[model samples]
Target: MDHREIVTSLSQEQRDHLTAKSDLPGLPLLLSHWGTILVLGTLIALKVPFWPWLMIPQGILIVFLFTLLHETIHQTAFRTAWLNEAVARSASFMLALPADWFRYFHFAHHRFTQDPDKDPELAFAKPATPWQYALHVSGLPVWRGHVKTLAVNALGRCRDGFVPPKGHSKVRMEARAMIAAYAVILILCVYFRTPVLLFAWILPALIGQPFLRLYLLAEHGRCPYVANMLENSRTTLTNILVRRLAWNMPYHAEHHAYPGVPFHRLPEFHALIEGHLRQVEKGYARFHARYLSELKLASRDASK
Candidate 1:
């Protein structure tokens, strides 16, 4: 069934229960996420034994804030509107993504998911060959894209179709503000003559982005370009830790099917519609394995 049909199939009571929002669940999760980042950063700052290695996990946690940013843009991360706005702005700064701009881009992605001609995500081609996949996952392109978007928007040259004309000013202002903030940060880092920010934030985010890339690819990679959300999005069956890190975004198909359902309640939503999911993966590892195998097969066929 299509997304609307699936929602319509649910009883009113079930629908109401699933869509209920509360701030309690999200607050603790946000706090714990930030707390973990703080602990890791402190260890790295203190230069504890094997401190360099700590950046790996540190980076993972930092980059995964993209998931938090994603949730906030949808305003489903918390019931409180101001909380969502505040968190979205902070996460966006950490990721070098402008929240106001991303909201428009992401909403358009949902509106035309997997549509080759329209989806802004489709503007960047997915990696097809092994070498291409390596470069893609290296996180280089993502960083480049973020930088380019920020620069262009700040210059008031953002011609992205998804961002409305009225929003152009807001997007421009947001990008300019982010650039100024980054400048201030860089000046402070230089004046202090310390690499604290470098080791604590920059390096970790760089090292951790590939993992995020891998995780995000599983969402719609190789899924069919169809109208049905269940068919178009792949829901990866991941472990509890990964689920928690990503704010249960692993239940992507459920989220796409019913965008109103908050992050905290995705598990229950998944249970209610588990049987209907068409592109479910057993795990991220399995998904990547199958994806690579298919890519190899396709390459061989093309060469023949």
Candidate 2:
């Protein structure tokens, strides 16, 4: 069955139960995220033996904050509107994504998920070769885009279709504020002659972003460019740790089908639609292996 069939099968009570927003789970999830970051920060601060190894986990934790930011943009991270905005701003800084810009950008993505012509995400093509795949997994493209986005928005060049004309000034202003914040961090690092930001954010983000890239690719990598969410998006079955870190975004199709449902409730949402999902993958490993296989096949056909 398609997404509509699945939705129609569910009773109104079940739908409400799944879509009801609450601050309860979101608060604990927020605390857990901070707790993990704090523990890693303390370890690095003390320079514990092989503390650099902790950077991998730290990077994973930090980079996955993108998922939190994504959910917050949907205003489903918390029941309270203010909490969602606060977390969205914080995550945007950590990830070097301008929240206002992303709000418009992401809403466009949802508005046109797999439309190659309309979806902003499709503007950046997926890797078509092994070398391109390697570069993609290095997370350089994400950083490059972030830098470019910030630079353009800082210059008040927010002319994208997703960002309304009325919002252009506000978007540019927020971008400038973020750029100033980053400038302050840079100056402090130089004045103190310390790599505090380096050890804490930069290196960790660099080391950890590939994981995020990998996870994000599976969301819609080979899905059909159709209006049906189940056919257009993917839901990769992953472990509990990944689910917790990503705020249940692994249930990508469910989220797309019912964006009204909060992150904490995605599991229940998935339970309702699991059998109907068309693009379910067992894991990221399997997803990438299949993606690469298809790329190879396409390359061979193109050469012929």
Candidate 3:
């Protein structure tokens, strides 16, 4: 989006709310991130029998960090933009993702929304004809959704090395710096005898990533796709655990609908637009628990 178009999307009320200071983030956030890094790292080092599987917690922790990185990049999580950027680095370290690269790409998701060519997260696109729609419903492979998130994240790094930053030297440096950071993490895990790769990389990609597909589908799965922000993405009403750990990203619709509004403020935005989001499903389990059943029904009906 050009400068004015982007500015226009966020209503004045939304803009005012974003500037309001709230204690939504406090010591609890800092301690949570610190605790996870310490606990997960120590567990990996301990090398005990089943403890090696501590990777599960470690990987989940990493997703939180990544999500939080998205928040901080937008400076939505803290009063001071500088402090948010500080927090984002820690998130990046935990996830082993290139934070600077993410900061750049995620903004694109905002500008483009669910536009297929412009928006990479456009899993919600609908087919034109009934036959094509049937193919889509049938082609929705549950496992592949998860698989694709990881595979794409892996492929993204290479492209990120070259993706132009928005004329900011700091962002450009951050891009290069993060790539180097990831490279260093890999080299250390491989050479210095750290199990970072097995725990942080392989297990998460193998086990945790597939879980993302259901969440992805719930966010903006397009039976109807349009510029209406509410229609394009979903904001799952998560349990406290998922809400806290996953960094409130379950508020996917709100995030898309208003990119400048940060995670802590998503609830306010949701309440502001409550009348709007009632139809778009919330809660991960509520949406996806019957996905397989729905698929079966769709298939049988199509056949008949």
Candidate 4:
């Protein structure tokens, strides 16, 4: 069945149950995520034996906050509106992403999933060549784009069609505030002659970004460009740890099909529509391996 049909087939009671929002499940998960980050950061700060190695997991945890940011923007991470907004803003700052701007951008993506002309994500285009794939995975392009976006938005010159005029001021202010906060952090670090942030946040985020790029690519990469969410998005069956870190976003097709369903309820949602999902992947590793093979084959075909 198509995505719309799948949704329509669900009874009102089922729909209601799936869409129900609650903070109970989110709070503990949030605490555990943050608690782990805190512990890792402390270990690094103390320069424990093989402390540098700890950055790997630390970076992964920190970078995965993007998932939290994504969910909170939808206001489905928690039942409380304020809690969602608060967590989104925090995650945005940590990731150097402006929450207000991203909300419009992400909403447009949902509205026009895989639409080459309209989806902002398509503007950058996915990596086609092996070299390009390496660069994409390196995360440099996204980092550059984020820095540029923040600067542009801070100047009140955001030209994205998705951001309505009413939100321009808010976006601009949010960008400016983020810039100012970053500046303060930098200034304090310099004044203290410390590399605390460099070790604890910056390096780790950079180290963790490639993994995020890989995970995010699986969400829609190579999926058919169609109106049906079931066809246009991919659901990667990943491990429980990854699911916890990503807030169940591994269920991308289920999400695009029924966005109102909160993250905590995604597994249940997946079970109901498992047979209907069109672009499910076994795991991220399998997806990337297959994707790489396809790229190589395409390169050879083009050369011929």
Candidate 5:
């Protein structure tokens, strides 16, 4: 069946059922999310015998909060609007991403998933060479982009075509507030002469960012420039733990297809669209290997 046929086959009742938002699983999910962080934090605070080893998991968890941020931007993380906003702001702050700015930026991404010129995400396409891939995976470029975005937006220089003029004030205010908050944290760290922030936030994020970059690259990395979500996006078959951590984002084609279907309901949506999906990968590892192999072949062909 074609994409439109697959979408039209679903009755209104089924659509409503899939789109119905609720907090049924969100509460427990949030608990588990924070619980993991608390456990890692406590272990770090106590300086346990193997505390250093804990950093890997801690950093992974910390950087993976970007998934939560992405979910909140869709306002699908919780049934309650305020809960979504609160979590979005918190996750944005932790990741140094501006929530207001990201909402529009991400919406643009959803609107134009793979449009070479229109999709802001396509501004920096996936790496086609080994050196480019190495740099892309390093997460340094992402950090630099975020810093520049925040600084410019804070200066009331919001020029992104996707961001509405009416929302520019909010974007500027959010950036300025974020800068102030970071300043306060820095001041507190200096006054207390403590490395708490370093161990707790900075170092962990730095260590964990590359993993996030690797995971994100598979989303639409090698997909063709097409309007069909099922074709342009990729759905990765990953383990339950990774699914939970990513808030079921591994079903990415399902997401780009019907973004209104909340995180809790994506698996059901996937079941509906599974046969119609054109881009499914077994796992991130397999996806990466295939992507690199193809890039290498392309490089050799170009040289020839």
Candidate 6:
């Protein structure tokens, strides 16, 4: 969206809220934030039996909260606007995504999600013709990885900013605040002399990022689209791992099609739309078996 599209002047009509979808009863969704803190605290306090298994639950909860925060970033999950922004940014830092930068590009992603020329996040997708596969094969610390996520925010804080399809002065201001925050984080790392492996770099990228990217990739990865949101995103079915870790985010299509529906209410929304989804395709799956299989075929083709 262009700067003109940001809609900063919330007119009388604009302030109106989305209608509630059902009376299946609203949930105490604010509890989700507390739940995240509880898990993070438990992990640090009980730092015993340091194993991948021990981290599984804690890391999963981190990812779940992160995803929920993502929806909040869109201003869809909750009634309280500032509360939604706070929840989104806090969870974003926990996930290592720059909330400032995320807010900038995410607005674009929503407006031009499927448009090959428009979406920033999907620059790694097929439309962007990226070398991410090569980067993946070479390894994770892709020097470019940091830049890819930060680039727009960097430019936007400049005079013209980047090609924001929406918002203008306020968007530029948010971008600047985020850059300042980034500096503060680095200062904290330097003061403690935290090892690159400990605080400066590795843990955030390694422990949390792959999970973040996996969550992102699954949303639109290799999935065929239907007539609407029901086909644009994937739903990982009834897997508890998917639900707890991604905050029921696997029901992505439902969430997008009906953004007013809170995360707690997504299952209800899904039930309402499931029939429409199945009729379009066979629904969705979480395994990366297709990615694995595609890489093998691509390797063969490249060798030929």
Over all chains combined, what TM-score does candidate 4 have? 0.99
Model 2 lDDT, residue 217, Cα: 94
- Distance from true location, Cα of 268 in model 1, Å: 0.9
Predicted structure 4: lDDT: 0.94
RMSD to truth, every model: 0.8, 1.3, 6.4, 0.8, 1.2, 7.2
Per-residue lDDT for 114 in model 2?
A: 95
lDDT of 5 by residue, 1-304 (tens): 6556666889999989998898777778777886887788778877888787787888898888899999888988888999989988988898899999989999999998899988999888789898899899999898898999899999999999989999999999999999999999999999999877788678888888999998999999989999888899999999999999999999999898888989999999998889889999999999999988988999899999
Better of 3 and 5 by lDDT: 5
Q: Weakest 10 consecutive residues, lDDT, candidate 5?
A: 1-10
In angstroms, how far off is 181's CA in candidate 6? 3.6
- Measured with C-alpha atoms, the lDDT of residue 174 in candidate 3 is 52
Q: Of models 1 and 5, which has the larger lDDT? A: 1
lDDT of 4 by residue, 1-304 (tens): 8989999999999999999999999999999988998999988988999999999999999989999999999999999999999999999999999999999999999999999989988998898989999999999999999999999999989999999999999999999999999999999999999888999899999999999999999999998788999999999998999999999999999999999999999999999999999898999989999999999999999999
lDDT of 1 at 167: 97
Question: What lDDT score belongs to each candidate, Candidate 1 first?
Answer: 0.94, 0.91, 0.61, 0.94, 0.89, 0.54
Score candidate 6 by lDDT. 0.54
Which segments of model 6 are wrong by more than 4 Å? 1-60, 63-65, 126-172, 185-205, 225-227, 278-286, 298-304
In model 3, residue pairs whose N, Cα or C atoms come closer than 3 Å (at least 3 residues apart or on different chains), thus clashing, are 124-222, 146-210, 237-283
Pairs of residues clashing in candidate 2: none
lDDT of each residue in 1-304, candidate 6, tens digit only: 1112222332434323223432122124446545654655455445545533434445445545667667677665565777677878776655545665566666666665555566665565542213554344332543265444455555654332234445554545555566687678779878987543242223433455555555555676666533345556566665565564566677776666655556666776566456656312232332455655676677678879
lDDT (C-alpha) at residue 185 in model 2: 86
Error of 6 at 296 (Å): 2.4
TM accuracy, model 6: 0.68
Clashes of each: 1, 0, 3, 0, 0, 6
Clashes of 2: 0
Error of 5 at 12 (Å): 1.1
Q: CA shift at 132, candidate 1, in angstroms?
A: 1.3
